[model samples]
Target: MALSTNRSPQDTLKIAQVRSANVDGTWAIANKAGIAYSHDPVLGVSVVSKSDWGRLAEELSSSEFKMVKIDSVAASYGALQVWSVQTPRFDNARAQRRHSGLGAIWAVYSDEKSSVPDIQDFTEPVDAVYTWVDSSDPDWQTSYSQFKNSVPAAGSHPTSRDIARYTSRDELKYSLRSLEMNMPWIRQIYLVTAGQTPKWLDTSNTKIKVIDHAEIFESPEDCLPTFNSHAIETQISRISGLSEHFIYVNDDIFFGRPMSPNVFFTGSGSVKYSLAKAHYAEASNPRLAVNLAAKLNAELIEAKYGKTTARKFKHVAHPQRRSIHKLINKAFSAEVQETAKHKFRHVNDVSVPSALAHYVAAAEGVGVPADIDYAYVDLGGNHLPMNLYRLVRGRGMQMFCLNEVASVSENEKRGQLAKRVLDDLFPYKSSFEK
Candidate 1:
């Protein structure tokens, strides 16, 4: 049922900046000028001038405003985490602070007329790449044992250790399907692992290729059997026949909405990176390596560009260019070389391939920071799987990541929940599937 606003169409429409809201809830309704508004249940949100209201009363004796309900608020209330659109996480208004390092310089580069023309098409071939490994693999375990005994950095917290890190959610297959269905602009997908391939993928599909880590390491004898993601990411640029531009994503990340190439790269060829802000606080998450990576990103950007550096990045797909990789390797040859030797994560290690790539690109004038639409959910907590369903059905995200769920002898409930969520999100098999 529509509630009465008693405002005439002529008078309401005459007021250029009108506001409207639900008379029952906080949801903002439509304004007369096609702008947004909210109608308060107790105190109506719409405000019109006296002249307009009098004219409205004369023109239309009875006019009522209908309530708009996007969804039930209870839908997103997680056990602890909320996935509602009302949450600041999904909106750009919550994007981390402005880029502090080389931000101004990059802004100039981005605005330069010569850097990128307005009409350029960014459809040049780009590859999608991921590095994956299941720790349960006997060969992987053997290699891990060899490194664990020799390297002091092989430390793993007993309480925090979970198979969730390497556990396969079958999202890799779905991610491939998403590319095939949503992002046709992608040229190929390279799943990098230790000679392991998902059984369900259609390898015969010429567009997809499985890259073994042995093929990219500079010194196979030293870097082979590596457990550090930073070390492995550093070598991905060396893949043979890889395109000049590529996107790196983890197995858990999936495309939620159809997107185009232009989202990651500007018409002028500058790569876009979404910078996330981190506040000053003691490192608390059990994931110490992530915090170390952010600090390293800040240090490197500050040293070269001489400004405060943004310490965090949105957990999303990474846009990478081969040329920047080469430049960083050459500039930080010794540090990178030493990092490759660390079989496991170390406190001193720099995130050269992950966060550092964006900082380096911006400093060199080849990239600009951009805020993209995406969602992130940590299923390790008690979040309802319905959050996943709602995010897609009401897709405000181009991509989203599912994190932290694993099975064990005692508790398989979380893993089961994750499986159900994935099935619900993408039930149909894509053409890329066997």
Candidate 2:
């Protein structure tokens, strides 16, 4: 059978299993060898044996499949060694496993007789929060225009108020689809909006809740009709019944593949945040609101801990702690209030969850810098076609973001392409959708 080049990692693993079952009968070989094995979602089947692995390895290596060794680090858990079974073409998608006594215990083993928790496993309830706006709504557009005219044109970032920033291509729908497909462990999803809900969204779904700005902000009268994302983000932690641990995601960000809780949090409930190589201190466009917020965040960190923060966090799903947000809100009451007061993106605004919260959490020794398999595609970039092609062909990324930084006319043209790409990536509708 010829597999499509754009197959997901799970698809690759399934293909490997079918070939193995056909070439080497599953029970005949394993039962004769007297080896115990279990099924792993990511690594296919994991066989644990007290005897030497030489015979099993040789028996599995055939013309259809090849066995390769993998060395992986389990962050705080130490080193992990596993042998992977892969096809020649789909080498990136492999079924792998190590001995029973290997470094860290796999999830497949954690369920069995071993009741001890793995150092990498995080069992706490983690929710997902998304801040979204629909610029096409007549009421929203009227409010946006009113706020845009109210603010002075000088000193404000060009793209801060750009319609591209608020444009919706049904990206939120696909993002939720990706979440349900890839990260099923999420306990609940809160869609924070400006009193507008997606028409296609299934509000009756118990897993999802729609939260208006009035519900989260302390002073809804002053902050309502706000077009500023920074302002909205500052009060996300105020959501009623929000979990202690949560991930803040933008409407354009997506989960590309299956992920474990360990990717965001440690066994001890500490956050693992991904940092980008880009730093605000070296920003080419310091006037941009995002970079300016980073610079302001650096200053705040410097003032609080005597340590300077220069690097920016990645545009992926940010792991956030409600307690940390409350801490920042109290510690920097003036700054946080100032941010909330902005009716639109202003020069004085500071990003809370995206940038500031990570730095503050790190300074308090609860957030650790980490790495992720991520990709960022600029919707307005010249190489958009190539970037999206690579994204689809290599369906191995953990997370990705499709950001539009173009003008209204430019975004209108690019929006179609983005929708097509999203539709191709996520064809199935999630329960959150109608």
Best by TM-score: 2
Candidate 1: what lDDT?
Answer: 0.57
Cand. 1 TM to true fold = 0.68
Q: What do the candidate models score in CA lDDT, each in turn?
A: 0.57, 0.71
| TM-score of each candidate structure, all chains considered together | 0.68, 0.78
Report lDDT (Cα) of residue 361, candidate 2: 87
Candidate 1 local Cα displacement, residue 355, angstroms: 0.7
Off by over 4 Å in 2: 1-116, 152-155, 411-413
Q: Model 2 over residues 86-139: C-alpha lDDT tens digits?
A: 344433332222111111122222123432335666778899999988889998
What is the C-alpha local distance difference test score of candidate 2? Answer: 0.71
Worst 10 residues of 1 by lDDT: 98-107
